[model samples]
Target: MTPLGRRLLILFTAVLLLAGLGTGVVLHAAARADRADQPQSGGPAVSTGKLTLGQKGRLAFVNGAAGPHRTAVASVPSTDPRGGRTASDLKCARFYAATGTGVCLQSVTGVLKQSNRALLLDRNLRTLRTFPLAGTPSRARVSPSGRFVAWTVFVSGESYSSAFFSTRTSILDTRTMRLTPSLESFSVVLDGKPYHASDINFWGVTFAKDDDTFYATLNTANRTYLIRGSLSRHTVTTLIQNVECPSLSPDGTRVAFKKRVLSGATLWHEYVLDLTTLHETALAERHSVDDQAAWLDDHTVAYALPANGKVGSSDLWSVPADGKGAPRLLIAGASSPAPS
Candidate 1:
């Protein structure tokens, strides 16, 4: 053959091989997505239905099961959390509700970057308002009186375990339609004296029933502190150290939080802090819990742990608030426990 013909033949062969590899990768990805839509063997049964935030004695969560209903807001009877689930059409990455009001954090893929938003939902799971988010959603909560909402997002790094990340926490008054775009704008009082820093970040806001008081995690100087915030005063004061993701109890007497088990480590153990006495009680769950817990009632606290043998899924587990009992499985294939 001529030298030019030989060179052409080699180039054509290389192009065909590259095309075949690209097709194979596309097919593999499509197959995985197809599998995700099908129901897994022995998974919990879920049905389409109207789910309301005002439904008394029901537990709502983001469904993590593999099926068409995956990522939908689902509910099971609080008395029988293991029973079949009724899933709503609304889907969210994180959700929380109180007194007929709900906050849903959602992410939508765009052509260039992912868009994130928060939806203020009514009792029937209808969108009452929508607020654009600055980054990826991380946490969400509604005040017990249903008059306030708050959420947090990671503005820089994706994971809290990363050494370098920034967060933006926002608060909204549902009745007045007033919004506090960032908690960093509020005045800070660290260890009695006024404090400020460029590296400060706040997240995981849990509100009190009073509608003006809230608690959140404040991070600065490589240390985490629990800060009690007031909406009326536009200020936050440091309460204690090393507390993250504070979830206040039903009666507002204690806060369920995850404390770092060691310095400079991502591991955490859940503990309850007495607001009056300033004492802490470690819960019975021995495994590292990385979620902001939800109070099941005055006596119990619930949180999600990664599901066994399942990727990108979690299960809800509950333990006594007094720190004496073993962790009990509350629901399978679920996360973001919201007890109504």
Candidate 2:
């Protein structure tokens, strides 16, 4: 399909869900019914990725995940104000907030041969400048300290004629722009191989509270797992497995990610795993709802999900930390959810 055709197809599907003209309500009712076997509660009926009581939230997402991708930096107020205003938009890629205010971010631009670029945008979304990366890097995430930046790159050998994939993971000091040398035949990771994997990989990195340690989402073999590592040691251990997303809790004892179950392509559910025990507990299940999870507090986890996956059919929602209440909608059809 053409790029515009694909985009319109995506948007049209989004519209159907938002209008409740799809199976969104039925799916949600079934999910809530499933929770009867779990727990029950009477809290907020709906909590948005958008704030409703002066408690603003931050979510950096590519508004259009399809072709002609446009990076959108959005902040939702405590109140349902204007359906969460867009703070800024970048050249044509995904973005992550470097500062709490969404200042520094890394992005990709089809305009530059899909070259990886670092960006600094003012509060109004004006382009301050763009820094090209050493090699074409992938997505980016800001460190917990808000001072350093970390991203993954596949130091692979793929060309027009040679179409094989073996990507090595790399990190950069966003403040310094210094990249750790590639792992040479197990240079950093001694026990396992470097981050060389087949295609259809979805690896993302995150830092610990100290900004010295890292965590990533790796899909290998037939199962997916979350791995934790340190930049200083360059060694990784399987923190937990059979899960994706790999977002760290503020306290660092729990991880919120989308755990695949049943038929993975049919269902993706939100889960929070205890780091020490590796025990996973489910939150909610809605098709096409995995990708991002944000911790609101030690007991609350917020996420973005599609109320419906039809035309214009996705919405943001959150489930309780204890799995006691039904999943509640926060907003409609958002791709990313970041809690402050």
Candidate 3:
């Protein structure tokens, strides 16, 4: 063959090989994402092996759909004492808000394919659409504007621990139920043990009003901190740390989070930190309760207290942001609460 013909043949072969490999990679990624996104259900199916036969998962008490009447509702199974790792047959309950015609969610258990799920309900506790998650959802949060939803999940690897690896975070359109994959494969140096996703992991997910940027929590060898990232930039930067369960304020200036207190011999307290000063102040102390907290507004925050009066069995409670007002028990003794 002529010299030109030989070179042409080699170039054609290389191009064909690269094109084939690229096509394969694209197809494989799409297939895996599709499989992960398929609607599969499982959660604390039957409170048998781990929990008491009918243990409540989580509860949320909100204003009724009508006027003046208050409603107390619980998630289908309500409480997941076993944490996120033991989700199987779900018992998500459905209820509608008694006020403002706003949508809502209760407790349902059993999640096999997805990690985090938000149950939508009507005022009377009626089940509506079940939100299925893709990849491994970590920090699931309703947008600060309440117009969107976002979650951080394990995207590529199965390493759900404190290790420097890649992870994917998803933002969903509540109005359309459409998921937009934003930041994927962001890595942080986690100098710690092989920590599970639920263990010492990032559960602090909050969105800004503009919905362009959001925050997430991640635990490292030393301390747990918050990270701010934008979909446009596809990057994350540390905002604050030495804390967990961060709930950002509505106005977007302050972030309310529970400071890390030693969970040993005797430790159960709530701490709020100032984002600007990086100062942490104690908010409340429950001798036996250690649960997640959320913010209702600038002055109001919701928290959970164990129901057993000792350990386990958590109920929802609301208190002032500055920790001055008397804490009010809202959902009696139940577990889990997600805004609709």
What lDDT score goes with residue 20 in model 2? 83
- TM-scores of all candidate predictions against the true structure: 0.91, 0.62, 0.53
Q: Considering lDDT, which of the candidate structures 2 and 3 is the better prediction for this target?
A: 2
Best by lDDT: 1
TM match of model 3 to true structure: 0.53
What does candidate 2's lDDT look like per residue over 157-246, in tens digits?
A: 431112443444445564665665342212223126555543434356766878777677655565566777666665665655676657
Model 1 RMSD in Å is 4.1
Report the lDDT of model 2 for residue 240: 56
Which has the higher lDDT value, candidate number 1 or candidate number 2? 1
lDDT of 1 by residue, 141-201 (tens): 9999999999999999987899799999999999999999999999999999999899999
lDDT of 3 by residue, 1-340 (tens): 9999999999999999999999999999988777653322442222112211122343233322111112233233334322322222224222222121223333323555334454543333344455654444334556644556555555455433334434455565656666565443444433332223333344456677786777676664546667666655555666665555577776776666656456322344676666777676666544433444666557766766655443424556776777676777655434444532
Candidate lDDT scores, in order, read: 0.95, 0.53, 0.50
Best by TM-score: 1
Give the Å shift of residue 153 in candidate 3. Answer: 7.2
